[model samples]
Target chain A: MKKLINDPKNVVDESVAGFGLAHPDIVTVSADPLFVARAQGASQGKVGIVSGGGSGHEPLHAGFVGFGMLSAAVPGPVFTSPTPDPIVAATLASDGGAGVLHIVKNYTGDVLNFETAADLADAEGVRVVSVIVDDDVAVKDSLYTAGRRGVAGTVVVEKVAGAAAERGDDLDAVAAIATRANANTRSMGVALTSGTVPHAGEPSFVLPEDEIEIGIGIHGEPGRERIKLEPADGIVDRLLAPILEDLPFASGDKVLLFVNGMGGTPLVEQYIVYRHAAEVLAEKGIEVARSLVGSFVTSLEMQGVSLTVTRLDDELTELWDAPVETAALRWGR
Target chain B: MKKLINDPKNVVDESVAGFGLAHPDIVTVSADPLFVARAQGASQGKVGIVSGGGSGHEPLHAGFVGFGMLSAAVPGPVFTSPTPDPIVAATLASDGGAGVLHIVKNYTGDVLNFETAADLADAEGVRVVSVIVDDDVAVKDSLYTAGRRGVAGTVVVEKVAGAAAERGDDLDAVAAIATRANANTRSMGVALTSGTVPHAGEPSFVLPEDEIEIGIGIHGEPGRERIKLEPADGIVDRLLAPILEDLPFASGDKVLLFVNGMGGTPLVEQYIVYRHAAEVLAEKGIEVARSLVGSFVTSLEMQGVSLTVTRLDDELTELWDAPVETAALRWGR
Candidate 1:
């Protein structure tokens, strides 16, 4: 594998150390248990927000740790779930007088670990609440998940919930906001190529040169179908059909449209996807109120794209527009 | 090539259209001559900053168009230099009452075309000053360039120069700042795989599975040497040696360290590189006063990275910290 790494075993630690050094003003790294926390620490009276998952999909939990976003992020090994120890440690570190909220993706491993962490934190006198995100509409169950797997919609949940917590919302309020955002969000992905994990030294799956995988999961889970490669618009139609119907997003409903790159795709292509998706939404009389296009959440060097749509009300829109300063996502500050 | 595009001939236009749609609040797209201009147009009295080049290396010229950055951007076909017509159009559109400055990379075609555009704009009564950025320390000259090819250091030039223009500096003053930044900057890149141009339908160059090209140019040009892929630190040592000696960067020199991914590499690996590069600098006693890391400048999904270091004074540091908003780079704002 042609990856710029020293040892596969040290990828997460070294990368985390580099992240801490690059943004010392924004985040602090704890080496003992490997959790990234806000450099300024948790606010005295504001509810703390924390989330985490596998290491390969970067800029997700760790890169989102900063003002107006996550308070702490716990990362596991590449494509593997973190144990409850680090999650509990992160929860404790992020907790303030207002308690803490854990935004967990709906994968079986992630859900179980976060649950155990919440219980452990509660035992230590910290009020903890957990909200599970299951916004991927591609499959009902996959390799690492029981129900629908959480995907790019986790970004929506983190941003909105983090905004609420930053504005001094209580633990319950932040959890409710996160849960609501997860419920209203839908995401679907298509992979043009499989990503090889550093340790595995091989691609997770073999895809022919002329075929594409539709409804693929972030962890290279088998998708709904694999078909011959088609035009960009045709692929968009297939991915968007399920997402729109799953949310049943109706005409006149305003929403935030996000087109994300699956690591290896360029920004130009992501914008092309965004352009056509926006055009399709306009044609269906659905209002594209807000738009985000880039590679925020990615599967280590996979070449593909994911589309996410989040139904937004006035409150949600305002929260989305609020100032945020993170290593990956930043705006309105 | 398996690319996410429609007709290869329509790639630039369609992507530009998508970019305009994605960031309508920040930029305005013109189709006639094809240029991306700031949404609010040129400030009434502030000197305008403009930059452009071939497409594919995205988020470079077009993505940098917004407040406190390029006033206008012109993009050509993929991996091809733009003609003088669009360059002139963008120049005229960005000209305020004060004047306009053109930041051109050192590639031969880009230099000649931008010079012609500047002359045309001068004839139109807009005072224009042009600055060429040639910060790659890779080689004295190579394909597509008469001098050292401009690489990721163009970002340093545009950002510092954009801030100068935004603060109401005259055209000459902005050009001087840009020239200074370019002079102090040095960059080197390494490529593990060649990037495929959409229209080319093949990779730019072929390489065996176990070797990498060090000092590789952004356009897949031949580099200094080809050797078996080594560990990340060893590769970084080789890339940083020439950069340090080219400027003869001395101990105690305060600088800004920028680690830019060349498209296909994952963020984790980029950070791993940054970790080692920063350690090397620290060992040399060069103070890393400011840091900018990410895939700001890219080579169309090539698996590689470029490292850039800019000597910073108090003025440049303040300018770098200035508030700016663009599709790709945004911070203090």
Candidate 2:
């Protein structure tokens, strides 16, 4: 694996340290427990939002930590879930007078660990709410997840829920918003190549040169099927079809069409995917009220694109338009 | 060869269309003689900043065309300079009563074409000032460049100069600031793998499994040397050494250290590099007053990172902190 890293075992800690250093104004790194908390600490009475998972999908949980977004992020080893300790530490660190909300992807390890952490935090007299995001419409179950794996749509959950939390919503309200966002959203990805895990030093999976995996998960899990390489538009159709149908994002519905690049894909290609996806949505009479096109949630250096469609209500749209100051998703602030 | 593009021939146009679609609030795409102009058009009497070059290095040029940045961007074919016609068109589109300033990267085709476009625009009564950015400290001259090839430092120049122009700097004042930014900045990149041009259907260059190209050009041109793959810190040291020496950055100098990812490299690795680079700078007593990380300028899907440091004075620092709302880079609104 040709990666720009030192001792593979140190990837998470070193990368988190670097992230903290680069965005000192936004976050403070807690090395022992390995969680990134808001530099200014949790706001006095606002509900604190915390989300985390494995480290490979960067700019995810960590990059999303800052004002108007995640209050803290606990990144585990690459593609490996964080233990209950860091999650509890992050939970306590982020708990303001109002409480704390945990937005976790639906991976089994992550869900279990965050649940354990939430229980631990609750024992300490903290009111904690946990929302599991399983928006990937690709599969019903995966190797690492009992249900649909949370892919790019986790970003949407974080953004909308983070905005609610930022507005001083109570823990239950924030959790409800997060759960609602997850229910309204759906995402599916296609990978041209698999990302190599640093520690493993080999691609998580291997595919023939001419085939592409449709409905691929973020952690290189098996997708619905592998098909021969097709044109960009065809691939977009395949990825978007499942997401649109799963959400049943019907005509006249307004939605946020997010075309996320899976690590190695360039922004140019992501735009191409966006163009076709938008065209398809337009044909269905779905108004593209908002759009996000970039590499937000990714699978290490995997080369592909994921299409996420989040059905938007007036309140959701307003919250989506709210100010967010995270490293990965910042706007209006 | 695995890229998310349709007809390799239509990559630029389609990608630019996607860009315009994705960022309708920021830019309006002009088709016939293509150029992405500000959605609000050129602000009357304010110096218009326009930059362009080959298409592959995205978010540079087009992505930078928005408020407090370029008024317009002319993109050529992938890795091929845009023709003088589109350059002239973009120059005309961005020209307000004050004038248009072309921040051309120091490339043979780009420089020649922008020069021709400037003269053509001048003939049509648009005042045009051109600033050639040659900040790459890797080599004095290489394959497609006469002198040093402009690399990531072009982003710094466009940003600082764009801020100056946005604040209503005149043609000369904006040009001077751009030139100063270019003069004070230096950059060097290392590529673990070469990016394949869409049409070419082959990698730009090939390296052994355990080797890396130091000071590699954005176009996959040979760098200072190809050495055995080393630890991330050692590689960061190699890339930073020449950048610091070329600028002869002094102890008292305050600089903006930009760690840019070359498409395929994950943000985690880029931060690893940033961490080490910051440490080295601190050791040298140079304070990092500003920081810009992530893939702003990129070689399509090339797995690498580039380090750019621009010596900042009070004026430049203030301008650097100015609001920029581009598709790729946005902060401090």
Query: Which prediction has the highest DockQ against the true structure?
Result: 2
Tens-digit lDDT track of model 2 for A1-333: 898999999988889998888889889999999999999998989999889999899889899898888999999999999999999999989888888999999999999999999999999978888999999989898999897889898988998898998887888998999999999999999999999999898899998999999988899999999999999999999988878887688999999999998899989889889999999999999999999988889899999989999999998998898998877877788
- Residue range B140-205, candidate 1, lDDT tens digits: 899899989999999999999999999888888899999999989999999999998888989999
Q: Number of clashes in model 2?
A: 0
Fnat for candidate 1 (0 to 1)? 0.65
Q: On residues B226-323, what C-alpha lDDT tens digit does candidate 2 reach at each position?
A: 99999999999998999998879999899999999999988989999999999999999999988888998899999999999999999999899899
Docking class of 2: high
Question: What are the lDDT scores of the predictions, listed in order?
Answer: 0.91, 0.91
Candidate 1 to truth, TM: 0.99
- What DockQ, on C-alphas, does every prediction get? 0.79, 0.80
DockQ of structure 2? 0.80
* Residue range with the least summed lDDT across 10 consecutive positions in model 1 chain B: B1-10
Worst 10 residues of 2 chain A by lDDT: A324-333
Give the per-residue lDDT digits (tens) of candidate 1, residues A1-333. Answer: 888999889999999999998999899999879899999998789998889989989888899999898999999999888999999999889988889999988888999999999999999999999898999999998999999999999999999999999998888988898988998999999999999998999999999999999999888898899999988988999999899999799999999999988888888788888888999999999998898988888999999999999999998998899889999988878
